[model samples]
Target: MGREAVIVGVGDLPLNGGRIVGGGSILQVQARAAKAALDDARIPMSDVDGLLVAGLWGVPGPGLLPSVTLGEYLGIHPRFADSTNIGGAAFEAHVAHAAMAIEMGYCDVALIVYGSNQKSERSRTLGGRPPILTMQFENVWGIPQPVGGYALAARRHMHEFGTTEEQLAEIAVATRGWAALNPAATMRDPITIDDVMNSTPISDPLKLLDCCLVTDGAGAIVMTTADNARAHGSTITHIRGYGEAHTHWSIGAMPDLARLTAAEMASRRAFEMAGITHDAIDLVECYDSFTITVLMTLEALGFCKPGEGGAFVSGQRTAPGGEFPMNTNGGGLSYCHPGMYGIFLLIEAVRQLRGEAGARQVQNVETALVHGTGGTLSSGATVILANN
Candidate 1:
């Protein structure tokens, strides 16, 4: 928190049929989002001296350096460049990195960009094992990818805390309720707990409705020094605090199956840095890869005690008019989930803080908390933003 970093611009491409309309590659959508961000900031590409790009899910060829590729594509000679690949939490981590870079005088203006064509490329089943993950034991035992890993966690939570399937269904139902208010949501129809329970079961205790949507989309954000943002005449959201933590990569290696330890550590650091309690937050933009993810995150973030997430979200507390408005833009469950969902969380949080979230807007939003979980709940990052 040396020199304050503020987000001056945010942009999101229109999600269409799990694809970017007009037949564009992952780079094309990324460029489009980047251009939109630049336009929103009223800053020329020449002014951007830093670049960070998330690794695309369905790139045509194997590339080791995504940030370099993007910088070359965008024709920007950035003084600072980074390609941090922590799955869904990458974007949030990028924000932190960009802030530090600006504070340390590594760069003045930084652009963080992400885009994915997972659905269009039929790459929905892309979460296998990363090169860093050498343990193939789970694969040999037929663990059925992320759905099965998350199902195992969900089942354990149910056993340890008496978290019922109905409680889990409540999360999906409430999120869909919010989605109904969002015009860009993929599935806007209101659903019930019965609808969730009756839906197709992907894994044991996790119905199809419990799972997040698979759609193609892109999002971007521009970060710079607070003085720079003010000089540009931009309505900026200050990055008050941020933190990150990682426990393990593989599900088999996870020390605790019933909880997300990283969320606890990261959120604590963020809250302490921001000097605010859970009650001080007006809204939460949590990465909802699945219904259980949101539930576990709420518990880990101290909104409720461990094992109390079921009761916390039971009566639509996270829905439109709930006491705690969470995932107000439908979240990954109903909103677009194009592989990595961290960027969208930032986008929604920024919109809410700016009072630009029409319909789904949370009233009198002074501060918002955004968190992301990546790689089978292996990694986590928390960011606190305030309009003041």
Candidate 2:
């Protein structure tokens, strides 16, 4: 929090389609995203001393080899590089890690990148287990997929706190409204409360619409010291504060199904470090892998009381130009989800702070809060960005 890390540049490849329009495999999309980010920041690739990449889906290869491979493709021989593979939370934590590295003068500019091709090619079926044989005996029998896992948590929220399925539907309906404004959104059908309610149930309480999209896309963001922002000739969105925390990896290990302890810790630390209250935050970008996930994050982040996320997103509060204005990019719900939806959260947040979003831009978006949770609600990271 002392030495600030500001975003010098941000960019992402088209979040729709995969290996179709010149973007082949996850590696190709990652390179495209990184180049776009460097270009957006107006910084040369040679200037980047540090690189952070996320392990991607598809392109059958070594698990944690993409980061170094990407650096080679970009011709960037960085001193410090990492390929953190903490599920979707990698991108969010990458920002915090880069900020710390820059604060300590470990590197000048760090590029956080993630890309995936879950749609075009994958061995795992829609509701099938991983190709690995071990998962059959250890996991799949317990839960069909992540949707059911999150659905169990959602049902617990409803049972304990009187949360209605309609409330969960509200978040989906509102995010779709924002997606309607985004031309790049995959499913812009303009759904309604009834539409969400009537959709085929994926799990008991969670309907098909309640889940996020599984498209293929990539996103990247560049971070450096505050001085680097000025040197790059880009509008600065300084990283005033950031926080990260992690819980158990699996759902059974979670202390509470309804509450996300990692998000709670990250949100509290982020607000305290930023020296601002929740109301001071003009916008929020929360990782919404599922409707329940968004609701849990809102509650844990103090945007709304515990068990009130369903009611909190009611009446388009998250839609464009709404009072709260959460996830304006249509989010993973309607926007291009790809695999790592976390990176898009930062992209939308930075765009709003820079006033780059055309119709979706909020008025005087000076401060924004972004939270990304990885694993099965296993990890949480938060960042407070301000134009100052």
Candidate 3:
């Protein structure tokens, strides 16, 4: 139970918009991603004893028993199985859960995976979810959810902190710049603040460019005890620290729209466990469902003061060659955002830590912080990773 948790392998299907030109099932993609990760770790499929998954690949009770469904597909009979779904941040929380499970002797090796074909099939109006639970209260109002909620946060930030539309645009533009270097990013063209401002408006002060892409995507991660990783001779990214928390399911219930309270709690716990300050972080990989998400996360994660996020990201500071590197896989804004985007954030962080990201790799990265926000900024999961 005192074992250290470490990531040994990560994998992704070649981004083809999640679905092929015509047909391919989410199950196939998920299986393939799992295989890729296992192969990368040099671990046979038969070796995995734990499974964690999240997705929207079924109906009728919908995603109920996702681990059971995916376990059957991969022929993995995991002793430790978890299918906790906290929206986009689910995978990040899975890492936390898997690490705890492995350390507690509940499981030796764990695979955390996710896949979504939202772009190929589901409607963006609902972001591939039915109005269940608190959503019933939200969807009935005719408010374009998700984006509308983020827009509310953005507008509130501007009102209380004097953040500007141009500042929000800085995030989109910088992330797009990083996308230009990513071979698999869906949106590679470089964009400007004016472009973000002029792009079709979705909600007040939130333009099309400020929003994330709707695309099919799949990714997987393989984690195990440090002994197992060293036994397999796998290059490792150690799970130095991890934390997760959620505030409210509905945007209406959020105490403060301008502040991402969940992110603060999660990242604070993560940093505390890692015994490191913000300066020790080499880079960041965060959920960028909207441009506002990056700004709010930066504040919540303590990269900058709550109101200083606007200035901190100015001049494309997070873009390639900037003092800080973030969302190097282009983030959900430019990278593929298949339904839940948190899995991709973890994958990218692992890749950067391993120096395997090729063109988008951050140089000499010893440690990276990965943060994910889910729901209407309702959930947060932070993982501090290290390869040093």
The number of the candidate with the highest lDDT is 3
Which stretches of model 3 miss by more than 4 angstroms? 17-23, 123-133
Tens digits of per-residue lDDT, candidate 2, 296-347, equal: 9999999889977777887778876678888898888888767667888998
How much is the lDDT of residue 166 in candidate 2?
83
lDDT of 3 by residue, 35-103 (tens): 989999988889899999987667555457889888888987999998988789999899999999999
User: Model 3: which residue pairs collide?
Assistant: none
Error of model 2, residue 254, in angstroms: 1.0
Candidate 1 C-alpha lDDT tens digits along 112-139: 9998877887766655554344555667
How do all models score by TM-score? Answer: 0.97, 0.94, 0.96
Which pairs clash in the backbone of model 1?
none
Report lDDT per candidate.
Answer: 0.88, 0.81, 0.89
